[model samples]
Target: MKKYVRGLAIVGVLTLAVAACGSKPAENTAGGDANKDFKACMVSDSGGFDDKSFNQTSYEGFQAAVKAKGLTPVKAESKSDNDYPTNMTAMVAAKCNVIVAVGFKLEDATDKAAKANPSIKFAIVDSAPATPIENVKPLSFNTAQASFQAGYLAAGMSKSGKVGTFGGLKIPPVTIFMDGFAEGVRYYNKQKSKNVQVLGWDDAKQAGLFAGGFEDKAKGQNTAQNLITQGADIIFPVAGPSGLGGLQAAKASNGKVNAIWVDTDGCVSAAEYCSVLISSVKKGMDVAVQDAITSVVDNKFDNKQFIGTLENGGTSLAPFHEFDSKVPAELKTELDTIKADLIAGKITLESKAQPKAS
Candidate 1:
């Protein structure tokens, strides 16, 4: 009855019955009889294959595509910023049909390697080059839409009537979640005539809390404790693996706090925190990665940008696992309406981090 957890290097496997739990289908890579020799490869950022966040999610998708299509898989994991270029170059040298570069920091490396090896198709996660690269497909998400829902959920569930959020950095990708989260709290206040306070972010000022980096769990834990002390009963962290600190902080809160997660479904990816997980604002890195690999393998590869929106199933709110019944049915219904409204343009989230349509 516990949540699923995937180990480092090895990928995910579901524990519960998918239908009963109301989770979305895992990324599909099953078709394509052509291009059996097509090789799919990836060059990871320093978090490498075990980040369980951006890097791991993308690799999982690429690996799934390799397995389903019977295509060969190749990978090189970077251990530092300096390793990005070297790892990418190695994949290119290996003649990988599609080379995926994980992380926004890999922009230069992906562009450089893509330009040098023009024949090979490329996919870049969480970034698009400053200049148009006709051979590189950019896979990015409008995570704000989903984070908004998490914010609203936190606001409704908070015993203290306050919630907090912090980021790995103040970058657009991270701040986008904060902006939408603040907006969601504000929206909840407006709708319910509640004065729910959102600590750590001010969307109008475009600034607030940030832990500075993705690797420091101590910073994340400290940030969570500080926010909890401020009467915020819930905290959302966009700090990749560092978000785990929020979990530890919540578990130590003497039943006064809960944590919302980002990137992937933390309920599954970080089962150790499942007892306190409110939910996750997921970016479909796995699907996008698999799509990129399959496109090349299926001989339909294009350099078009793939923007993940809630409507397109690219970004979403994960189910309340341990907290399923704890979340009121009425709040769940409202979230469904908000999702449809956002997709229908009846409700809109404004953030520059939103990936543009092709």
Candidate 2:
């Protein structure tokens, strides 16, 4: 929660146990002979590592932990839903001491893998299993809190008085963002007596637009263009790689449209679209992934759920970047107040998709 630091190296000296086959020990410097056999692996969702989103952020953490501990690093990238089980099985066959499965779609496969292979530690990003598995830990986030701020920000900045958002799927993880974003706009309307509209999601109805999945940029672009046609000046896309299409749409609008990114800072991860980005809703998936790996290496692994919140450093809004000069000073001050109020519980979000507070 405090963010990953060199202090994690303290756990590097311990050895992780993995009795599975298909793995040969590799030499390492940090953890000595015991750690030489320790192998940390990851399984990506269909979005892959270059999605400039959660999958990429999660892998960064996994690699950081492996690098710090001098453990063997391995990964399996899924090409589609059907690949989940097969990729996870490959990690098991590779004798991975710990395997981190990225994205909520991997929940079933991760749950099955952990139960079938009780000895291997597992962590799943963005989701937790229906029933607790002793070998699996859940890495989740209360992204709604940060997205609430993004919603408010979009509302305050919209020139057309309309904002829009769409998700990659209809799952809790994705809807959670739309819920918060919609509510944020509603909050702004209440405070300013302005009729700022949210086009793609209706939090009360628990329904809105979705790209069906996270991999198709064409669908995302089409969805964003639709919102733009409806006069939405600011768009939010919660669909990993597909979300890039929203940026593409915004860019094509010239100076008329702008957007907000999710998962990672768009300015840093998708610089080509920075001109149209207002900001990003960020999750500390990298830190969570690294912490999970560190726990495994220290032999202190548990199935406890790791819930990231605004109170923790687990979720936040990225800096305004190029929009810094354009956002009004009063609006920035108002955002600060809103953030403080949210943290103090003076403001409450209405999203049913938010993860249970830890």
Candidate 3:
């Protein structure tokens, strides 16, 4: 009787171990089965999380979606452009139902990966694949409208009557921001009858300082300083990561200078210079990502591209933080009017190849 009892106990232990092993595969497979639960994944560009620009904004969006849907979300950060493909592949292999790639820099890699993994769904920010895949969705922003607001504010607030803009690359998105900014300045000038000169990238020449790369803060600082020395009291740094250098330069200039930040709210993100930042171009990535994930959760994930524009309430200008009191009441009123006009199609912020001279 004792021998029989011991043998039964051993068998029970084995049964429990086997049950535990069976549960492991369920957890692994649970994420991929859309019928059960959807898993979302993201692969970031070389800028990483703290770049204080596109990467951070995109990540925030992805996180919001994950939280809202109660879905498992994974992120693979690329140290360089070369790592994009490999990191993307790893997420695909993990059976992520949806993968979001941040930044235009990941366009090529994301395109290749999406094609290779036909079963996987993809969403990319700031870019669209050349050939649209049925499974991939593109998300782009109307940065022009937001930047135009920044320009209008800068033009109205510039003490020196000169504002400048610098970009890391002359890409369409960056150029669109610059174009809208220039137009805003022109609009402000036309409305107020003031001459505010804009320097740095010329829409006509289609030329500007690249800073060679986006990660070089020193270059950004120097570029901004040069623009400041040329009598630009307000400067817009549209270059990701490098924009921080511009902010630093503005701070070192002893509060006489101010800057406009891009992608995220610089006031909250860069609190040290919040006092100097006039405003920021707001991109609603958080909302976009949340919407994308919700669609997946509700089994309504459609192969539709998302365009975040002013009309859609996907982008706007951040409120004046420390400059709230400094900005005149009249200027604020005028800015509101302009925003309304732009939204209502009363005013069009058209992209032009020629830079209007101050």
lDDT by residue (tens digit), candidate 3, 101-184: 776777777778888888887777767655557777777777788888889999989989999999877666567778888889
lDDT of 2 by residue, 145-254 (tens): 99999999999999999999998888888888899999899999999999999999999998889888888999999999999999999999999889999999999998
lDDT of 2 at 63: 70
- Candidate 1 per-residue lDDT, tens place, 96-163, comes to 67878777777777888888888999888777776668888888788889988888899899889989
- Flag clash pairs in model 2: none
Least lDDT summed over 10 consecutive residues: which range in candidate 1?
A: 1-10
- Sorted on TM-score, best first, the list reads 2, 1, 3
Best by lDDT: 2
Ranking 1 against 2 by TM-score, winner? 2
Please give each candidate's TM-score.
0.88, 0.90, 0.86
Worst 10 residues of 2 by lDDT: 2-11
